[model samples]
Target: MNIKEKYEMSKKEYEKWGLDVDKILEELSRVKISIHCWQGDDVTGFEKTQNALSGGIAATGNYPGKARNGEELRKDLDKALSLIPGKHKVNLHAIYAETDGEVVERDQLKPEHFKKWVDWAKKNGLGLDFNPTIFSHPKAADGLTLSSPNKEIRDFWIRHCMASRSIGEYFGRELGQTCLTNIWIPDGYKDVPSDRMGPRKRLKESLDEIFSQKIDKKYNLDCVESKVFGLGAEAYTVGSSEFYISYAARNNIMSLMDTGHYHPTEVVSDKLSAMLLFNDKVALHVSRPVRWDSDHVILFDDEIKELSKEIVRNNALGRVIIGLDFFDASINRIAAWTIGSRNMIKSLLSAMLTPNDKLKELQDTGNFTERLALMEEFKTYPMGDIWNYYCEKNNVPVAEKWLDNVKDYERTELSKRS
Candidate 1:
């Protein structure tokens, strides 16, 4: 038996106990999720995002090209605002300044640009999802490891942090909500060991400095999704699992779990512990995992097929804020992202609707023996209901009756568990 069989058995037991299957389906289906527009390649233009019929867009991108010429990016932003068809619009990325190597250019920052963004947010009622990447003059070739040893490099990084905080403060004052100044550092070790402990120390220091400037209000650092990787497994120094968690815990920062960041074969239990321990600090980066490759695939297949159920288990469900991490460099960026988002919502709905109270109960108890037993029972069970929910949610109506048959079968098998 495997997980599917166990779930089926549990679903049957739940139905017998009078669980409202439709309500469960509706609750799961109604869960709110949002994704960044940058995840897809075809997301370069504005028209593709402004959805009038469905939900408004969640976008994060480099300021429109006009901003570079000392021209206003906010005007383009205003134009984009007019394009959105819904009441809620979100900007998921922001960069205050650009820094590369030893050179830093702070003089070009027109405080007016900040004002423009805030004004736009007020008028359009948009939520900003800010990022602290590529905000300085010296471009990070190796990425912001936050552990650099050089004083120049360290100061450069700190400047970007300050700029991000300034923008957050402004947004907080105006919008009554602080922008989530999210960070995803590419800083890691490669090949040789270098003495950079002092510079590495600046990571927390910079963050603290920015946080301290807040005036009688609150803001969210939305835990940084750290990863440790290099071109050829030379040895990553930053964003590795251990370092990220430890640093986050020590610095009073939250943890946002990106499924693609973990070792592909990590056990579901371990993933649960990581999310639960950091539950209050948790935010999910919704994407599929394949062989340590964070390919932002359309998540309906083997990639995220079963793992999503594991996520909702162990009480890590409600804290989820889904997003697409698919890079634009992949396939038809637009179509892939649109389909991926649709599939992701469908997947969550399917998992949300599963009537496996027993399996959920077994998961909560933390008893290894029972867990193994449930896993065994899940092996041969046909979870056609799960498939049907997924299909129906995605508008494939033909699977409705097929799903009913599967649910009946599951209920029958579940009776044996008691």
Candidate 2:
């Protein structure tokens, strides 16, 4: 049957559970996913003295058509965003600064370095988010950043982070949206350390110094990210989940949870609900983890659906800031972005279309049998029909048709890149 016909049939099915499909679509449009910019360039920012991928993060594969500069990365994003439905914010790192061939040190970075990004964001009516890049730098060679025992190293990173907040403030002032400036450090030892407390103490002091400046919350929102462990720092990570969670709670800032940054058994889906219950606001980096903390593209899988469901059911949609964080250089960069971005939006739509209240009532009433049955049956619902209709309405391609656009771009635009 045609898309509209299928959608009408699906709408009737969902309406059986007292769902408003039209309202769901309207709600979906208002939620924005912050698409990561590094995915277009494999985390190789436009720094003059670029270093090898470090901090336990690596983007494998020598994709032939990776964007080499800021202009090309932005062009690639234009194509990806056009294919993906709705307007969203672009997440940028400190290393992505446009310094006009001048070697500007990270600690001394200013807002003018990102004037082009702000201008482009203004032209496209897209919001912007900032991240302080603490990995893959000379200072972080020992895999120790803020937690380093060396006073000079810790102080330098402190300045860089402080400078990063100023840039975030600029973005907010320019785009009229509060910029989320997230700090993620890769400071840990390869083996067991005798003095874990020392590093944690240093990290705490560095954070206090970085946040000492009282930037207005209207212009910039501060965030701290934590990790279970990483490549070089297998034994211990200074910014452990416990540390940041406590710090954020006490400091009244947002705590960021990256899906891939946690242990293998832990799922971010459950954490979302718990975080929402206690904190006023929490940020999420939606990424897939393969085996360990391997940053893989996000999929519309069971976990993501659960994650989205928590946000909707708990009424925490407005309290959470969602962003994508995965980089793979193995395939077409634009297509990677398209697949992940589309899946993120699709997963959220699926959750919104679900009969959450009915299932919750069943569970609360001790009707586990009916709850399980309905949950399983709901999986077979005709979400694709409604999705295709949403894409058509949004002026984007339906189903697999979007991939055709990516292929055309590869031949005409990406293939020409070095």
When summed lDDT is taken over every stretch of 10 residues in candidate 1, the lowest stretch is 48-57
Per-residue lDDT over 1-418 for candidate 2, one digit per residue giving the tens place of the 0 to 100 score: 8888999998999999999999999888888899999999999999999889889998999889998998998999999999999889999999999999999999999999999999999999999999999989999998888999899999999999999999999999999988999999999988999999999999999999999987889989999999999998999999999999999998899999999988899999988888888899999999999998877898889888889888888877788899999999898889899999999999988988889999999999999999999999999998999999999989999999998998999999988977
Kindly give the number of clashing pairs for every candidate: 29, 0
Once model 1 is optimally superposed onto the true structure by TM-score, how far is the C-alpha of residue 321 displaced, in angstroms?
3.2
Over 4 Å off, model 1 = 1-22, 40-91, 95-126, 135-137, 142-145, 169-178, 194-199, 215-219, 267-269, 302-307, 361-418
Instruction: Name model 2 segments beyond 4 Å from true.
Output: none
lDDT of 1 by residue, 374-395 (tens): 5565543434555454344434
